[model samples]
Target: MQVVIGKAITYEQQRLIKIVQKQLSEIDKQHLKELYEVTRIKHEPKDFSINEVKREIECGKDIQSLFQLANTILPQLKISNESIKYYASLVGYYSVYKLK
Candidate 1:
């Protein structure tokens, strides 16, 4: 995940970025690290990202559904309900940054 903080940031976008940074800071990083270490399969999954979904949500696009988004991102691993929900939650967290 490479992030480039460009010189063209708006005040509103910067504010939202701060909010996301704060929300991210409150999360238990170690737990997520452990979870990823345990649950990841050997296969290289699809290439979509939460940022992509956040871009869609920010654009006011009809995202249709989280399950659909999950399938788009994690293709082969949608064998269980929990996996989809988990990925959905992570993706949904970025919804806070959507333009309101």
Candidate 2:
């Protein structure tokens, strides 16, 4: 997930990005930073929308905090119930995997 940072992000999107970055490991942050630079050079749309940010956070490895974040932000995003269920399942799968 490379964010292009093409345009000025809204305050909500910025907040979501900060939360995602906070949840990321140092290694993942470094990797994403490199990807961000490359995507910016390629002129790709790396700028994360609020929804995209929510999706990324939903799929993050840190299950507990990520799930909590999702619960907190999804409603704010006004995402559909189906999308919420999808993310919940993804979180459940990852959480189980981590327990193995």
Candidate 3:
């Protein structure tokens, strides 16, 4: 996306590029958040329950704490750092969303 944005040759093009970038960012965030929710529900972590994580997602307090918990548990499930980071950002973004 950055590469494409950089290719813009006009002022209007740049503005449109920014809008596209912002929209893509929001879409990425939504996908990540959904993935985070699904991952938590699909896997039972020793330190927490699926319902507990769901409740936390609802309240959105300590989203990073949930990220930390995901960081810890993902490795046990043999998930890669890329996946952990993906889910971590998903949880982290949920903090900004503030559904409660």
Candidate of highest TM-score? 2
Candidate 3 per-residue lDDT, tens place, 31-96, comes to: 445544543433444557887667656645434545554454444455468965785466445543
- Whole-model lDDT per candidate: 0.41, 0.50, 0.51
TM-score of 3: 0.24
lDDT of 1 by residue, 12-68 (tens): 457655553444332333333333222222223445698666654543333333224
Local accuracy of candidate 2 as per-residue lDDT tens digits, 1-100: 1354533346556776676666667755554434322222222234689866665555453334434544665666655799768854553345333422
Pull out the clashing pairs in model 2. 3-46, 4-46, 4-47, 5-47
After best superposition, candidate 1 residue 22: deviation in angstroms?
Answer: 36
Query: How does each model score on TM-score?
Result: 0.22, 0.27, 0.24
In model 3, where is the ten-residue run with the lowest total lDDT?
A: 36-45
Error of 3 at 96 (Å): 8.9
Candidate 3 Cα deviation (angstroms), residue 68: 7.6
Candidate 3 Cα outliers beyond 4 Å, as residue runs: 1-72, 95-100
